[model samples]
Target: EAEVAQSPRYKITEKSQAVAFWCDPISGHATLYWYRQILGQGPELLVQFQDESVVDDSQLPKDRFSAERLKGVDSTLKIQPAELGDSAMYLCASAGALNTEAFFGQGTRLTVV
Candidate 1:
């Protein structure tokens, strides 16, 4: 079965440090999404990409975070000068189309001290 792939299953960093995460979506998927999930809350969409272009990033904190799908396949998300409040699970998911079901990776958990 096809699945989304994420690296650095866990990460730990001091407040104000920089961190990044990677994700490789299932083959042929046209839509990819990056989400931040707090332990007690539902996941929030940070950014959405269709092919190599960003379709929506209204919720993404432009001053501190960024996401990219350079080749329209694998993608990366970065947080510069991470803060304590940024500790959460970063999830990556992909779907072949808007109405199709998406497959998610075992999220990258970030802990900021």
Candidate 2:
């Protein structure tokens, strides 16, 4: 199976604290995405990048969340002054130029107290 690498699989942070998660997609994939999943719910798209440019981020909370794929290979997602509602699984996914069948990482489990 193809792999997308994510770091710090688990994170515990206090409310109003900042947190960051990282992902490295498959070597040649050019499309990447960041998603947030609440328990018992489907993953929700937070951001999408085609190469280094953002394709979509309408669902992202601009007031506190940000994501980037600087060189179009690896990406980072950050949340500042996180709130209790921010607790969820952050997942990273990648797809080829065709943009079909994305491969996903194990995801980072975040708990904001």
Candidate 3:
């Protein structure tokens, strides 16, 4: 079965430090997403990837956040100089290459001090 894969179920970093999260989307999928969920809020789409190409990243805070799907498959999200306000759940989701069912992985909860 297809499943989204995420690592380091949790992360703690001091303010102004850098951190990165990794994800491996279900094989054969071509659409990937990176979402950030604030406490109690719905997940906000941060970036969307269609294969190795970025289709949407308008909501992504470009100043500090960066993501890439180098091989058009697995992906990575990085935050430079993480901020206390950057603390949140980073969720990786994937849909079919043609936009079908999407699945979420247990996220990486970031805590910035």
Candidate 4:
């Protein structure tokens, strides 16, 4: 069985510094999603991809954040000039067209120091 993969279970960065996180979605899944989870709050959708096309990114902060899924399987999220308020758990997940269960990878806990 394929699984989502994320790097650096924990990350510490200085305020206003650049940071990046990576994810590999499950094989054969066409939809991939990135989410941000703040302490004590439910995860919120950041962006989503269907194949190589962006399906929804209305919640993404284009002014400070960007993401890409090249070839439609793996993806990267980047934040330039991170701020103290950017600290959160970044989660990667994917679901098949017929599968409703969104499988999440162990998230990268980002801390802006």
Candidate 5:
């Protein structure tokens, strides 16, 4: 069975440090998304991409966070000068097409001091 791949399942960093997370979606899936999930709240879309082109990123904090899918496949999300509020689960999901079923990766849990 195919699955989304995420690396460094856990991360801990002090405030003001930098951190990064990576994800590789299931093969042939075109729409990819990154979400931030607080412990008690539902996931929030951070960014969305379709074939290397950013489709939505209004929620992404451009000053401290950035995401990229350079080749329209795997993707990376980075946070510079991480803050305590940045602690949460970063999830990666992909879908073969719009309105199709989406698969989610085991999210990366980040902790900031």
Candidate 6:
């Protein structure tokens, strides 16, 4: 029973600075997703990838946020010039395929002041 790996469980950054989170899903999972969860709210999808190709990222702020899975294994989510509204938990999840049971990471909590 492997698990998803996330780095820097907590982060604090001044507004307008750059921050990034990394995730490595369980081996052999083909679908990876990035999500943002505000306090008291459920996670919201930020990006989805299938084998190195982006499947969806409509909810992602293109100007400030970006996500990528170079080899379809590990992924990164980055925010440049972070804002106060960007403070939240960044979560990474993976599933064997779409609509399957997904496994989640511990999540990276970001705070922007």
Best by TM-score: 5
* Better by lDDT, candidate 2 or 1: 1
Report model 6's TM-score to 2 decimal places.
0.97
Report lDDT (Cα) of residue 56, candidate 2: 97
Clashes of each: 0, 0, 0, 0, 0, 0
lDDT of each: 0.96, 0.95, 0.94, 0.93, 0.98, 0.96
Instruction: Pick out the ten consecutive residues of candidate 1 with the lowest summed lDDT.
Output: 1-10
Q: What's the true lDDT of residue 87 in model 1?
A: 97
Candidate 2 off by > 4 Å: none
Q: Top model by lDDT, which number?
A: 5
Per-residue lDDT over 1-113 for candidate 3, one digit per residue giving the tens place of the 0 to 100 score: 76899988999999999999999998888999999999999999999999999999999999999999999999999999899999999999998855578899999999999
The better-scoring model by TM-score among 3 and 6 is 6
lDDT of 5 by residue, 22-104 (tens): 99999999999999999999999999999899999999999999999999999999999899999999999999998999899
Shift in Å, residue 104, candidate 6: 0.7
Give TM-scores for every candidate, taking all chains together and pairing residue i with residue i: 0.98, 0.97, 0.96, 0.95, 0.98, 0.97
As for TM-score, the candidate ahead, 1 or 3, is 1
- Candidate order (lDDT): 5, 1, 6, 2, 3, 4
lDDT of 4 at 17: 91
lDDT (10s digit) by residue, model 6, range 57-93: 9999999999999999999999998999999999999
Candidate 2, RMSD to the unseen true structure: 0.9
Alpha carbon lDDT at 72, candidate 6: 90
